[model samples]
Target: MEYHPEPVQQLILCCSCGIAIPPNPANMCENCIRNEVDITEGIPKQGTIHFCRNCGRYLQPPNYWLSCELESRELLALCVRKLRGLSKVRLIDAGFIWTEPHSRRIKVKLTIQKEVFANTILQQQFQVEFTVANQQCDDCDRVMAKNTWKAVVQVRQKVSHKRTFLYLEQLILKHRAFKNTTNIKEVRDGIDFYFAQRNHAIKMVEFFQAVVPVRSKSSERLISTDIRNNTSNYKFTYSVEIMPICREDLVCLPVKLARSLGNIHPLVLCHRVGNTVSILDPNTLDAAEIQSAAFWNNPFSPLMNSRELTEFYVLDVEPLGPTRGKLMLADVTVARASDLGTNDTTFLVRSHLGHLLNSGDHCLGYDLTTCNFNNDQFDQLDAGRIPDVVIVKKHYPGRRKKTKRRTWKLKTLTKEQDELVARKQDLKRIEQDYELFLRDLEEDPELRANINLYKADDARSVMTNGGTDMDETETDFPEVQLHELMNELDINDEPDEAMQ
Candidate 1:
């Protein structure tokens, strides 16, 4: 039947160009159709991407801050979503074109297909150039403007030194616990963290509860109320008080509390302070943990801290071999460093740090022979029950040597100082506190495990001069191993302006 023919299908000339094509909508040749109907007509060739320099986040319109890396899928999607006329066409492909990172420019190449007339589909590819314009985000603006906080966290510790605060600061830096804070103010006794939202402050308080033995209490004040909308705004304040006891402190616990902790000695050394106060009897090496609730119920400040430590020359160390964990019972002969040249006086005492002491090595201990105690717990102890000297930690010499620059460093948060002008004494105090922190890191293996240490950019400089990162002649402190440090590029998820 077909042999009689479907009348030879007629071909139509292109409307714009004299080209023949099968009769269909948009009767034009492919080149003419592409030139006449552009699928990317309404899309702009250039756009602006709002960026927050303070936070390193891109502003998605309508007040949303998004964190996306350059050339990432999330960033590409965000860039495509910024285009106005893309909805009219079917998106075929979208990708990023590499450009100078510091140039603050982003180029996205887009391919789209759209139907022009009847079955004629037109596809086009074009690039959109986006220039980053710095704009302060809501959070950053609040930080610049004082007193814009909805919640405040005041961390206080009634201590003479800032050693505990420094430790807490390292923990916060390692965990990024201050990420949501709008402002961090260093106060006289402690730090104050301000947050735009109440939940962020709550999370910080919870973090403090987990990291340190602290008692926290919260209070809220009504700021404004809208009866019509059934809405009310309240400002919240969280007060966190850390336990006064710190690492390497001497404690004279109450008789009742001492008996409760497995009948351990009341006279103990603060081994390490964390969520709980860990105390070890220097005589017996008996360890116990004091919880936050228990500590606050009957809190007592340390009788003496590391500041009271006196250097002693070790004359002898005889290990009795009664070991508990890393500690061993021993009879130690020691003379005060000050008395070594003048007198022949010596004291024999039982110590828990017997395994770490050498005959010629110097160590720090608490001298109770000449000191008088005023505490009720100490008064209750019989004079014969108290030891003459309590060994605390081994002393490392050569700290007086030139302060060689470090090969590695830690990252700290940007904080606001409560003091408008730092006094010389304050600066000196800060330096001393930092030195103590460094010594703690070198002496205590457990403390170093909780923090992230990054290799500094000038790490190779020290090696070039000293033949090693930390030369034996330069410093006697234990070297921080390379395996414990992380390369900046390996752990950096956010884009740094300096790097860009």
Candidate 2:
């Protein structure tokens, strides 16, 4: 209103750099003030990291936990990434000072460079502190808390044996298939795996499908619902049933099924030498594999098990032909253990222990004559009244005394024994594969060259005398560097196209 220009305002100079700037409380220019300001202003003095004591993993954000051998470095990186000051400054390098084991506090040295002014960059070093908090991750917490699973996988086989479950358990452990499983329970005929997520259960089912022939059915139940938040929680159950047959069992095939299977045999022996079940004609010594679909459509029932086996004494034996590896053909005259009379049955049978059998030797076999034949008319007609013996093992007379006959129950490996054997076999196979891989690496020219290129100078010198050094004659062409060698021949290179 006075229309008067204010008296000429006096300009002040920066006290530190002697630069003229607007008057302010500090009497410093914009550049000087900016340089003086700390870029870590909004950063927390003490950062907390959630650590899972159970699994020894550190929590990343949003319900994710990372597993690493160097937990401290991982935690430090995660905490540094969460700092708000990092957005304003350019980080050059950062390092953590060593702290005592189990220390709550961590110290980090950060070298940050910031462009406070045009064509002007300022670099500074500062120390930031972090606090480690021992807390359970979501998975570990769910595992610790009972009955907190989001999905349950019930692995079962309809057979009376747990052999398939045992094999599945070994596969799971060897491949770490159940890495996300929260709990495992050993049921009567199978196993139950509890997972924290439905996807994990699905992943497990997929693994089963890849390795074992399985059929799965899934169902879900509503746990809770939040109408306001539009969220619902559910618990899922996946029932995965494996094949109902195992190795070394006597199964009766229907007449129609036998005809479908190339009229092989009605009274077939189930021998699971590999993944598939090979139905063998005990009389003709012919075999045919039963596929998953065929087996599911017409599943064979076990007519007799190993426990129903009895001993027989060989009266006379004659080799019919040349041996076929461990199997051979022989005409064996044998009498049952209960019958020591001169009446002995002679059978032209395929025997695994034919070479070891001599006159008067005792052997164990399943008595097919006593098998119940109700609906299995084909077996009743084909194997009726004939004391055919499927030789299993050799027996000694010095063993324990025979016990009284009792009711027949299915024979199966106990849980402990089966698991132990499966684990051992899995480990043995892994070791053998590893050894074969090492041998191949040593023998493969490209792999050997690449390995030599990465070896330390001292190791190379030591290996030179043994003629195992990298091919130095190719130096004229090109001295293959480590990176080039890696690109050319990787140790984990896939199989050749022809092999695939």
TM-score of 2: 0.55
Q: Which stretches of candidate 1 lie over 4 Å from their true place?
A: 1-31, 35-37, 41-48, 53-135, 227-231, 400-404, 467-476, 489-492, 495-500
| TM-score of decoy 1 | 0.81
Clashing pairs in 1: none
Candidate achieving the largest lDDT: 1
Q: Write the per-residue lDDT of candidate 1 for residues 1-500, one digit (tens) a residue.
A: 45674678789887887778887677778888877777788999999999888887888887778887889897888888899988888999999999999999999999899999887788888999999999998766766754788999999999878899888988887677877777788887899998889999999999999999999999999999999999999999999999999999999998888888999989999999889999999888899999889878887878898889999999999999999988899999999999987999999999998899879878899999888878988989878989999999988765532334666676666666767316678878878877878777867778989987778788777757774544465365566777887876644243322111
Q: Residue 187 of candidate 1: its Cα lDDT?
A: 81
- Winning candidate number (TM-score): 1
- What value of lDDT does candidate 2 attain over all alpha carbons? 0.62
Scanning candidate 1 in windows of ten residues, the lowest lDDT window is 491-500
Off by over 4 Å in 2: 1-49, 55-103, 108-128, 224-233, 273-275, 311-328, 332-348, 352-364, 369-375, 384-387, 393-500
Q: Candidate 2 residues 1-500, lDDT tens each?
A: 67988798788888989977767766667667666876566656556666777877777776667665443576668868766668778889888877776677777888888765455566777787777678886555645753688899888877644445544554564465656777676565577878877899999988888777667899999989999999999999999887776656777777777788887767667755234567776445567887667767876667765546688888778777655445555767777888776555555455545667888788778876565555655445544524467876556554212111111111112122235335765556434434323333332334333222233334334434543332443222212233322222335332121110
